[model samples]
Target: MPSRTEAKGVEAISSDGNLSTVHAQTSRKERPPVDSQDGWNGTLQQSEAMAPVYDWGPEIQGIILSSCNYASFLVPIPTGYIAGIFGAKYLVGVNLLLSSVLALLIPLAADAGVLSITVLRIAQGIAQVMVFTSQFSLWVKWAPPLEKNQLINIAISGHLMGSFITLLIGGFLCQTKVWPSIFYIFGGIGCAYSFLWFLLVYDDPIHHQFISAGEKEYIVCSLAQQGCSPGWSLPIKAMIKSLPLWGILVFHFTEFWIFNILVAYLPTYINSVLQANFRDSGILSALLLGAACIGTILGGLLVDFLHSRKIFRLVTIRKLSTAIGVLVPSVVFVSLHWVRFSFSASMGLLALSSVTSTFCQTGALVNILDIAPRYTSFLQGLSEVFAYSSGAISSTVAGFLISQDSEFGWRNVFLIAVSINMSGLVFYLIFGQAKVQDWATEQMFTQL
Candidate 1:
C-alpha cells in the first residue's frame, strides 16, 4: 500500500464534513515527556474550542467495547443451532432489524452513561452473532462444491470492505461534532439492507421463491449427493474428538486474537503515537484495511485456480494458504514495534500484515464447509465461540498495555499478538485437513 502522502482528496472531505481538530493530551500523570529532541512532530495542545460530546475517558471506553466483544460469541452456539433447525432467512432478517434499532438508539444510550452503553453493546453483540450463524448456514446449501472457496471468500470480503468504509467515514464523522450521526447513518443503512435481504435471499435454493426450477434442481441434486437433509441432530461425540475440527477451532481462536487487536488498536496507534490528526488517521487506517479487502479477493482466486488445476490436494492447498496467511503476518506484526517510530514504515508493515492475514478467509474460514457441509453452521458457531472468547482478552490486554502509553508497553502488546499467531499456525499445521469427515455423512456408516 502507498504511504499516507499519496492519499489526496481526504482534506476536502474533512474540511467539508464539520471536521474538528482533535488534540489528544496524554491522560496519564506519570508519562514522561515525548523526546521533543527526537524530531518527532506528532503532538499538539487540545483545541479549547473543540468540545467533546462526551468525556468517558479511555478506561471506560475500553470497558464498554470489551464488554461488547466478550458478548459477541456468547450465544452463537445455540443461535446457530436454532438457525440451522428452523432456517436462517427470517432469523437473519430479525437479527439485523433488532440490531439496527439498537444502533439508532446508541446516542441516547451513551448519554445515559457507561452502563446504558454497555448494555446496548452487549445486546447488539447477541444479535450480531446471528449474522455469522445464518450466513454459514446459507453457505452450506448455497455454495457448490467446486466453487466453495470463491463463493465464500466473496462473502467474507464484505467484512473487509465494511471495515474499510467504517474507519474512513467513521473517523470523519467523529470529527464532525455530531458524533451521533455515526450510529444513526449506519443503523439506518442496516435497517434498509435487512428488507432487501429478506426479499432477495433464502435459506436454501429449495426455499427461494424466485429461483428457477432448473437452478433449484441443480442445487438440490448437488447437495443431496453430500447426504444433506433436514435432520437437526449433530454428531456431538464425533465432533468433539475430531482432530481436524479441533485444529480449525484452535487456529480460528488464535487468528482472531491478533485480528481483534489490530481492529481495536491500530487507529489508536496512528492517532496517539504517530500524532496524525483525525482525517489522516482515518485515511491511513482505511488504506490498510482496503489492502486487506484486495488480498481476500486475490487469495480466493488463487485457491480456486490451484484447486482447478489439481496442482495439490485440497488439504495441502488449505495448509499452504494457512501458512501464508498466519505465519508471514506473525513476523510482520513483530516487526511493527521495530518500525513504530517511523510512520510510513509502521503503517506499511501493518497494511501488508493485515492483508496477508486475511488470506485465511480462503483457508481456515472455508475449511469448515470442506469438512462438514451438513453441519457447517453448527461448527462455525463452535469455532466462533472459541475465537471470540479468546479475542475478548485482547482489548483488556491492550487497555492495560497502553494505559500509560509507554513504548515498552506497546512493544509487549505486539510480542503477545505475534506469539498467539505463531501458536495458531503450529496447531493448524499439526492437525488441519480439508477433506470430508466421516461423521458428516453418518448415513453412509449405517447403510454400509
Candidate 2:
C-alpha cells in the first residue's frame, strides 16, 4: 500500500471550493435551484465569485450535498461482517476501484443533474465504506498485540498524510486554473493504487506468494494466543450489552463531532476567523493534518513503549491517551475565539490541538482490537456507523449555528465540542476496558 491513502469527502471539496470571490459584476444566467440537464460548462461558472453555481438555498441544498454521508450511514455493519467472512483482499481492492471510477465520473454526473451527482456520490460512499470496513480485518491476520499500535498507526497514518498532501496539492491545483484537476489526479491515483493492491497485498501474509516463511511464522506465532483470525459466528447480543463497546461507540460519535468540523470547515473557519485568504487557509489546514500525521505515529510509539516496559497496564495507557487527547483540545477549543487575535498564536494552538487529538488512535481507536480482536472488523464497522452519522451532522450543526448567530456562532460550536468531549471522556474512563471480552473468545457459547 502507498504510505498515504487518499480519502476525500464531498463535504471537504464543497467546503474548500473557490476561496476567491468575484468583485466584478456581469450579466450572467443564474443556474436553477437544482440542476437538471445542465451542461458541464454550466455546472460551474468559473467567473462566479461565490461557491458552487447551484442556486439552491442552504436548506434543500442539503439533499444532494449530503447524500454521501447519508448513504455511508446505511452499510457499515453488513460490509464489515461480510469482510470478516470473506477475505479482505477483494473487498478492499474492488471497492476502491469502484470508488475511484465514481470519483472520475462525478463531473459528468454534475452535468447530468443534481440527482445524477447525488446518486453517484451515494454509490461512491457505499463503495468507500467497503474499503474502510476491510481495514481492521486485514490487521487481525497481520498484527501482533505488541506491534498493534505502531502497525495500525502506520497504516492509518496514510489517511492523515494523504489528506495533508491533498490539501497542499489541492490548493496548488486550484491555482492551475483547471477546476477538475484535483479530482482527476486523485481519482487516477486511486485507480493505480487499487491495481497495485490486487498485485501486492493479500488478506493474510501466509496467502501471499512473495512472503518469506520466517515472517509468516513470526506473525502466526505472535497472534497465536490472541486468536489471529475471525470466526463464522458473532455474539451480537453480548456485544450490545457490553458497556465497554458502548464506551467506544459513544467515543466515536463525539470524536467525529469534534474532528470532522475541522476537516470539513477548517478552511472556512480560518477564512472567517482569521480573515486569511484561500491559500493561507489551505496552508494552515495542511499544517494541522501534517501535525496529526506525525503525532499519530509518535503517539503509537509512546503507547507501545509504556506498555512494553510495564510502566502501566495497557488499559491505563489507553485511558491516559484518551484523557490528554480530549481534554487538551477541549481547553484550546474553548478559547478558540479569544486566541484568534493573533494568527500565529491561533495556528500554533490549532496545531497543538491536532497533535494531541491523534492520541485517540493510541487510545479508544485501538481499544476495539484489545477487547475483541475476533470481532474487530465487524465492530469497527458498527462503531463507524455512529461515527459517520455524527460526522455527517457535525457540519450541518456548525453551519447552522454559524449562520444563525454570527457573533457567537463559532464560539457555540467550540463549546458544544467541549461539552461532548467531557461527557464522552467520563463514560470511557468508567467503562472502556482493554481486556478481551469473555464472549469474544469463549468456545462453549451457542451459535446464533
Candidate 3:
C-alpha cells in the first residue's frame, strides 16, 4: 500500500487529472514561499492557528476539551483496561507519555515505511481514552455539586471542540501535505499540558492548596446536598447490577454510534455526495459539532435551571431530557428520507437533528455520577466499552455501505443510526427509572 502522503497525491491526481506530480512541484517552486519570520515555519503553528483570535478562557477550555477529545479517539484499549484494573492516576501519566512518544514516532514510522495506519490510529485512540476518563474523574472530585453540570459541560465541550478542531484542522493539514505535523503539534502541546494539569489539579477540593476556605466549605456542602458521601468507597457490585447503569450504558452506546458515524464519516459523505473540497467539508463538519457543543451547554444549563426552580425533580429532568433528545433526532433522521434538498440544506437539517440528539447525552452522560459517584470512573469505563464497541461496529458497517454503493449513499447509514438511537430511547422509556429504587435505598441506608 502507498504511504498516506502518496495516497493523497494519487487522490489529487485522480481528482484533477491535469495536475501531474511534476507540474505540482513546478507550481510550488513558482509560488511565494511561506516566511519563517511570519511563523509559517513550514508547518501549522499551534499557537498561531488559534492565538489572539480565540479568547484565553475558551483556549484553556479548548485544552481541557482537547484532552477529553484526544482521549475519546487516541487512547489505546490496553490503557483503558489498565485504568479499570489499577487506578486513574497511573493511567493518566502513562497515556500522556505514550501519546507523546507516539507523536515523536509518527515521523519515524513514516520514514521507515512500516507504520500501519490502523495500528497508529489505534494507539492514538487508546491514549485518548486514558487521558479523558482520568480527567473526568478529577472533574467529579473537584467540582461542587451545584456547579457539576456546568463543569461537566465545560469538560465535554472540550471534547466537542477537540473533535471540531481535529476535523477542521486535520483536513487542512491533509490538503497541505502536513498531516503528520498535526499529530506532532497536538502531542507536544498535550505533553506540556499534562505537566500543568498534574501541578494544578487535585483529586478533591480539600486537597487543593489554592482554593479558599469558603470555597472548600461550599464545595463540601454542595456535595452533601447531592447525597454524596466524602471518602466513600464505590459499591462496585451494586453499581454493576443497577438498572440505571444499564439504561445509561444503552443510551451511551446509541449516542456514541450516532456521534462516531457523523463525525468520522460525514466528511467522506460530503466529499462523495456533495462533491465539496476538503476545506468546505471541514467547515461543514465543524458546524455540525459546533451545534453539538452548543446543545450540550444548553442542556446542562436547562437541567440546572430546572433544578433551581424545583419545578421538576432531578430524576424527572434527566429522564425527560434523555427521552426527547433521542426521540426527536430519530424522527428527524427518518424525515430526511422524504425531504429532498441541496447538500448544504441537507447538512443544516442534519446539524439541527444532531444538536437535538446531543441534548440527551448531557443527562445520560452525567447520570453515572448521580447514581454512583464512588465508581464514576469505573462506570464511565463500562459505558465507554459499550459505546465504543457500538461505534466501531457502526463505523465498519458504514464503510461497508459506502463501498457497496455505486453512487453517493449515506441514506442507509443514517437510517441505521436513527434506528439504533430510537431503539435505545424506547428501552430507556420502558425500563429506565429516574429515582433510586427501594433496593438501592435500603442498601445505602444499611451502609450508612
Model 1 clash pairs? none
**Local accuracy of candidate 2 as per-residue lDDT tens digits, 1-448:** 2111122111122211211111000111343224223342332345343333444332223344345666787788888888888878888888888888777787567557678876887788788777777877888878777878987887667777777766766654543344355566777887887887777677776776766778777878888877746867888788889999999999988988887667656765675677654445566677788899899888888988898889999899999999999999998999878987798888888998999999988999779999988888889999889887886787667767776876788899899988987898899999999998888885635465
lDDT of 3 by residue, 148-254 (tens): 67667765766676566666665555445544555666667656755655564455667667767887787767766655432233455665577767888898888
* Candidate 3's TM-score: 0.75
Reference-based TM-score of each model: 0.86, 0.87, 0.75
Which ten residues in a row are the worst by lDDT in model 1?
Answer: 7-16
At residue 248, give the lDDT of candidate 1.
94
**Model 1 off-target regions past 4 Å?**
1-53, 444-448
lDDT of 1 by residue, 225-310 (tens): 86665336777878888999999999888888878766666666677677665556766777887898788878887888999899
Regions of model 3 farther than 4 Å from truth: 1-90, 103-115, 230-241, 335-341, 436-448
For model 2 the TM-score comes to: 0.87
